[model samples]
Target: MLSKYPGAVFRGALSGAARRAIPASFLSLRIALPLAMAFSLGLSLAVHQEACAQTDDEQTVKAIFDERLTSGEMYYLLEDLCKNIGPRLSGSEGAERAVTWAKEVMEGYGFDRVYLQEVMVPHWERGNPEQVRIVDVEGGMIALNALAIGGSVPTAPAGITAPVVVVHSIEEVEELGREAVEGKIVFYNRAFDQTVIGTGAGYGGAVTQRFAGPSQAAKFGAVGVVIRSVASNFDDAPHTGGLSYLEDVERIPAAALGFQSADRLVEVLEVQPDARLYMHLSSKWHPDALSHNVIGEIRGSERPDEIILVGGHLDSWDVAEGAHDDGAGTVHSIGVLRTFQKLGIRPRHTIRAVLFMNEENGLRGGLKYAEAAKESGEKHLIALESDAGGFSPRGFGASVDDDVLERFRSWLPLFPQNTISYVNKGGGGADIGPLRRETGTPTIGYIPDSQRAFDYHHAPTDVFETVNRRELELGGASIATLIYLIDKYGLRDEKAQ
Candidate 1:
């Protein structure tokens, strides 16, 4: 069949070879004429095949974007997940409901398979609202906005009241020694670095205080710990994230004060330097609960054994609806599969969508998934995660070699201008990290605009209303396009170890 289009095929071969120009005058006429014709015939067939594949991929990607923009269902699904299911903290009724809803939705979509992978997840509850007050100062008692850190031990019914000792980092606490920190409440007032252009970078710089401050302060006999919220914006709303406790050290209650409240604490300290604080946190940890990693897949027609996975965590902090932290990612995963089915695009490699559980506090779901894959000998060719937020698409970050990265960068021009045009080397996400480490699966993280993500991260402001429909849909489309590309032309030299 290809022999009929000899001219077109020869042109395709010449186009590919043009990248590394070969001289035509090197060959003598008698040998060159016949040999060149034979070589062209063979090369032309291969070239034609390659060009056909590229054309199909281009058209498919365009169709994915069009379908997502015109009839995308992720926005409405997110509305239900956020408004109806609400916050899906691990072990909460909300989480159970979300699991059921996700399973049912995937089944309704008629995926080839839909199931759950059982996992034991930590269960932490915010028993009651937290209380923090600045006292023993010239201004009398002043209340400060606060929220208890996840996985923190509950304070006594009456709570603890002690003199406040402020410090910037854990190093400063060690320098102060036990004499100054003992029997006092340690206040970590390190603010997010404003100079960092990426809000995630700024969050990383200041998040240690929230995650490890309590246990570090406890080493010096501190009764409690209060950290300034790890947020970019200066607002009265406190951001709450998970805290870790050292087994060797005493577990003490910890909470995050809102940006404005931290500022007030600093002001009071400057004037009196002997301020006392009374803090009450009712957060508690229950026994580990059984959860499941919700999974759905569209089996590939050609290479069913090889898998491509995309996912996000289903759990969120208990404070808000979790519309962005991961609610966007959850629906985004589903949207990818939905778009494939809607476009009737049968993939070459099985595409699986996993909604991980307990990513906010524990990585049990991710760990369990990796373990199950290893035990079952399931092969994952590539994994991608979308946990950044439902914001404008900004390409993907990959934990791949230089050659693979270059191949991905070459496709940047295929994407729409100003949408998903960048590719960088980095870890994919918390949920996919284990898979990469355990199986050497190439991982990709969907990168989105980060300027506004931290504003509502782990706070009550991360609600359904904060997400934009266009931005969220665009993200879904971008993910689908990437998945389509991978399905068409699998990542460079991917092999399951």
Candidate 2:
């Protein structure tokens, strides 16, 4: 390393002494100069080593983050993804295009290894436009804007047109009992509570009704299930999300009515005492289709056997552009890996980027991924998932033992300038959950403060325009810094104090 400094002293060395080699004094000068040079070199090396031992290079790691963030590729790439691919529902042609595009983009980035892991995924097709109409004694019929919830079957050629029964929650249906609910449209009337400071809290309170309400109503012998729009603000758009059916109970058609339609249904139900509804859905489930989990890796230098995992689900619900739900997440994950590559800051463990499939309806992608890792005898050091929207990052939530949690907590104070203080023990992510339960590898979730997420969470308003470019970049830097620390310092083996 010191060879480069020889040029600075070369001219002075050439100028020293009048004659090139005066016999007696020249020979003595040569021997003394070489000895002095070796001794000075040894002393200089000791001082440099001590300085390095005293100073931490955390600031340098953070500098890489700052520089890359100032000029990151995530926002621009996300723009093209949303503009071209639009919506990438699991089985749709759009999703296939996204797979190709993702593969090409990563290869374009010049990854050392770029490949796809094949995984079979459920293929539920949302057919042509669905129509829903409310019948009034005077008005006769009023068509409403609505969409069939994912995984719904077609309601015959004539369609399912039944009397609408508006219920506040699954509890209401339980109270109404099978007698009242049989052969009627069960409408879940729970609304997202906008008053909550953390809008994610409001979404958490309401999403359970969307996921489980369908099966719960099926238990009571209902013909179909309809939940009120899952949005904080009023709109005509019907938000669609995942719904699961119980094993023994019959599977009924389910849909989400727009906020306005839900309100009118209540009013019409009051006047007529019995208002009928006509809903026609055209949907079907094809056989499982082939999908891929795109994986990229950066090999470690020393402890290469240990692995650090980071990912975002590639499949999104087929409505809007699927921007905030996961497009933001997908791009953010890619950005984390790209940041390291651009800075030439190589991780000490194998760093992986896994774009999971079928996360919206089924966790088949995550399940298959964990199984493959276990089968291959790969020891996952830690897994981090980012599915929550790319709002400003708050901190990480871990599904770790107490000691591991403490180690993460110790780093929280380091993030004060970024206002990230909330590292704690919690569920990692839906996709990463199975890995934690099965592999015992620690998992972490990227959590942004939950304000305004529920407003556009699953609604059509969740377009690419909703993503804040600055906030997204900040989030990418935050995760990258965490990865740097974890890779440099191994995780705690026991519970946190």
Q: In TM-score terms, which candidate is top?
A: 1
Provide the TM-score for each candidate, comma-separated. 0.91, 0.86
User: Model 2, residue 451: what's the lDDT?
Assistant: 75
lDDT of 2 by residue, 1-497 (tens): 22212112233333343224334554576587875676466546554554453234346456755754678579888888888998888877988888888888888888767788888888898888888888776649888878888898777778787777778777888999989888988988898887887676777788877888888888988888778877777877788888877888888888888889888887888888677888888888999989888777787777777889888888888877878778887887777678889878788888887888889988888988888887887888999998888788888888887876777776664453764667867857777777777788789999986775666666677788988887787787778877877776667522230
- Highest-lDDT candidate: 1
Q: What stretches of model 1 exceed 4 Å from their correct place?
A: 1-12, 15-55, 493-497
- Model 1 clash count equals 0
Question: Clash pairs of candidate 1?
Answer: none
- In model 2, the clashing pairs are 402-495, 402-496, 403-495, 403-496
Q: Encode model 1's per-residue lDDT on 29-50: one tens digit a residue.
A: 7777776776677677777776
For candidate 2, the C-alpha RMSD (Å) to the true structure equals 9.9
Residue 387 error for model 1, in Å?
0.6
